[model samples]
Target: MDENQEAWYLWRHVQTQLRVSFGGIVGVDYTALRHVAGILGITLDTAMLHKIQALESVLLKKVK
Candidate 1:
């Protein structure tokens, strides 16, 4: 797959793993993940971050 597609795929996989492992515990601190993504040349933005946060919020609510 192309770079964009690959990045998206990886992001999705990470999101899934995080959801399962953390049980939807989304931390406010995303600097590490964002840095890692940056090093990997993935284009992440505030909006995307918010989406991930939203996913975590939903999951957190479910667990609670």
Candidate 2:
């Protein structure tokens, strides 16, 4: 595939997986999402890392 098409495909793939990962994290825990992503060979981007961290902070606050 061409560079442009390949980039698009990778972008779409990540986007699709991110949806499912976020859904799982929201329903379960952030670690569950990280585990699943690791099993699926997906790496978290900086933005996603920040998001998960933020969610963890929010959840911790709710717990306390």
Candidate 3:
């Protein structure tokens, strides 16, 4: 897959895992997300990390 596609794939899986492991976005911190990404062998670049952070923030806000 292309870089963008790969990033999305990683994001979806990581998000799912965070929800499953932590019981939802409220319990998912960036550190834990990064650790899980590492375990999944996904390398996150600065831009991708920023995007993930932004999305996580949105999710957290919604949960609140």
Best by lDDT: 3
lDDT-based ranking, best first? 3, 1, 2
Q: CA lDDT of 7 in candidate 2?
A: 28
On TM-score, the stronger of 1 and 3 is: 3
Q: For model 3, where is the 10-residue window of minimal lDDT?
A: 19-28
Please give the lDDT score for candidate 2: 0.47
lDDT of 2 by residue, 1-64 (tens): 4634432333333332332253243333445566655665656667656655555556545644
Clash tally, candidates in order? 0, 0, 0
TM-score per prediction, in order, is 0.46, 0.40, 0.53
Give the C-alpha lDDT of model 1: 0.57
- List the candidate numbers ranked by TM-score, top first: 3, 1, 2
Indicate the residue-level lDDT of 56 in model 2.
Answer: 51
Residue range 1-64, candidate 1, lDDT tens digits = 5635544543554554442334545443466557656777766777666666666576667867
lDDT by residue (1-64, candidate 3, tens digit) is 6756656666676665454335545544567677777877878779778777766777678876
What are the clashing pairs of model 2? none
TM-score (C-alpha, index-matched) for candidate 1: 0.46
In model 1, what lDDT does residue 51 have? 61
lDDT of 2 at 34: 62
